[model samples]
Target: MPVTGADVRRIALALPGVVERASYGTPGWRVSDKLFARLHEQDGVLVRLGAIDEPELREVLTDAWRARAPKRLVAELAEPDG
Candidate 1:
């Protein structure tokens, strides 16, 4: 089943110290007043995954550049019943 905003809220609220608040006119989740997640008006939800080391970030970017979805998985998702 597809997830909804309420599902997101339920999960986020269960986390320790998480609080729901309005951020930039949208729903947001914060811990200790630090914004950790937010729902965008045009885009979908975003989560702050935290800072990564420079070297690790470089490697991650490089891997992303080479990544490709498997044809089978892509076809599955493209099906009407997916």
Candidate 2:
């Protein structure tokens, strides 16, 4: 089963070094304020993952990335951090 947003938030935050916050209406995961990932709304066991490097992960996870923001947002996320 896919991980739930709340679980993701709790686990990511409780991990050795991960922080969680609100971003785009979902839980944001960061390491030292750098956004590495985020979660989407889920019902039952389906959920999405989004991030600045989403495209790179998309190739690995294939359709699973859809649980995140639309494909176009990937480019926006690709922008260099400022």
Candidate 3:
């Protein structure tokens, strides 16, 4: 099945300090208010991830979150989940 905005939202929100906001009138995901992913036309989303799986998408979102989040926040993410 094709990925949906809800799927993206679910994975992105799991990351440290990620939130959903509006971007160009569509749903966008951000870390510390820094945009990492936005949902737009099918083409736009596909351009970012060409046929990606859930695990891969999670990795991608985590990497994006790590890049945009504050140093301290990223460090917090490094700690193992209890």
Candidate 1, position 8, lDDT: 54
TM-scores for all candidates: the values are 0.51, 0.41, 0.82
Clashes of each: 0, 1, 0
Candidate 2 yields a Cα-based lDDT of: 0.48
Q: What lDDT does candidate 1 reach at residue 16?
A: 46
Over 8-79, each residue of candidate 2 has an lDDT whose tens digit, in order, gives 555454433345677788767765455656765565423343332434433433322223434454444455
| Candidate 1 regions with alpha-carbon error over 4 angstroms | 44-82
TM-score of 3: 0.82
lDDT of 3 by residue, 1-82 (tens): 5556678888888888888999999988888889987777755443354477777788888887888999988888888970
Q: What is the lDDT of residue 53 in candidate 1?
A: 41
Prediction 1 TM-score vs. true:
0.51
